[model samples]
Target: MTIEWKGVMPAVTTKFTDQDTLDLQMFEVNINAQIEAGVHGIILGGTLGEASTLSDEEKRILVKTTVNIVKNKVPVIINIAEQTTKGAIEAARKAEEDGASGLMMLPPMRYKAGDRETVIYFKEVAKSTHLPIMIYNNPVDYKIEVTLDMFEELLAFDNIKAVKESTRDISNVTRIKNRFGDRLKILSGVDTLALESLLMGADGWVAGLVDAFPAETVAIYELQKAGKIKEAIAIYRWFLPLLELDINPKLVQNIKLAEVATGIGTENVRAPRLPLVGEERKTVLKVIENGLKTRPELPDYKNSDLM
Candidate 1:
């Protein structure tokens, strides 16, 4: 599948069973829901998917499962958050072998690599695979920003196609467009900044809350792109509270709770990350409940050719 590198590409969460096994049934349910809701692509084993906890075999299974589930209707992108250059290269090759359409790679995990090291790591991984890559430039969480200088150096790799812009500085979208001039596709990685980023010329959104509210998420992107600004803002205003959940430390749990509320998923996460509880749970649930109570009737943005 040729990746368009645009539209609502969800960083979907991985579902688990009570015995702590991959719940393939529920995973399929969510993936189908995302596709039916008009998402352009699906990303597996991302932060929201609990990438660090997953073994290499488990990640491979996810790639195969998503590739099979989407059936080439949308690209299945696997996230590579390895601790070493060798590990990242191996994972990239494995994803391509497992039938992934592309990769969403972060800078080498664990030890923060400097500018030169980061560029080299990404370049080596790029050289190792035929798959196009989207650099996860999230300095705020990962602590090492892939600055413009590094991006300039990286432009030599034809496979380095896009950036998941999570820097949270909305202006960075314009800066990237100015610097690269459409050479690199920009997807807003922050849920809270999604609409603004899209309006400011982001190519797409690598979304978090879309796991549960796939239609609403897709609607916002489609409406914005169709030039229906007023209609998009109406839904985005209602979605703001729920979208903010993506920024929290417990976002996975919060979004899982949402999936439960919507009957699309379960709250069964892996260990070291328990389900939300007490006031945290209550507060999060309150937001979800309120959003549900007043969920807006979506416009027929799907009929627009922008999709």
Candidate 2:
């Protein structure tokens, strides 16, 4: 569907201190850089941001910090998802009260079985908040399959405006775009499939790599929007490999490491998630180096660049 949101909105990470507390300063620093680089939008408290581990206070800080830093320059969607419908609604209500532009909500986690029960779960959460909600479809991470029919049913509610589809199945992107094309906002969740999804009629994407390289993300969208497919493809090819790491359980640390490697943001992460080391760190660094070599104009690694 034609809508106000589109293109390379990174699932922004929440920076933290070694003590595992929220690093509000670095959060502002990173968010401001993404905004200045011209991302189509910004997302706070998404999976890539490790929203699962953050406390309610921390989540509130994330929403307020992001909304203030963005200052309405681009769309800022807050992830208001929890294990309970009440918690999710509370988070969504808080984000709305704090002035977030939109909300991306995940299904209730920590449960098992039954599609009918799942439907009721969604119905309850949907009823709790008035904010525009993007139903997150991420079975890979959450272990719950939010089916196409379920999504269609959710659409009966007027506030369910968008979706983050990440089944790792590109065809579903086409399916959602085709089936719900007239009704919901279809945002391809995987960064690697941004190109395919775009051509397949997805209105936009929520990218993980955009955290480390907002300029490149914005460039790909701009190039394609200008009908420069070849240029856009080049950018996508360079990012596809790194983007795949978003599927990795180590996504938060991986993107943070990429930030450290490129001076985009801190590699600082909360525990029990340790910093990457040994072969893992080496592998991630190589990806960053090659990505930089492929596009040197994409800002050199420098402290000044992050701010």
Q: What's the lDDT for all of these models?
A: 0.95, 0.77
RMSD (CA, Å), each prediction: 0.9, 4.6
Q: Compare the candidates by lDDT and give the number of the best one.
A: 1
Residue runs of model 1 more than 4 Å from their true location after superposition: 305-307
Angstrom error of the Cα, residue 202, model 2: value is: 0.9
Per-prediction TM-score: 0.99, 0.91
Error of 2 at 30 (Å): 1.3
**lDDT (C-alpha) at residue 126 in model 2:** 69
Error of 1 at 166 (Å): 0.4
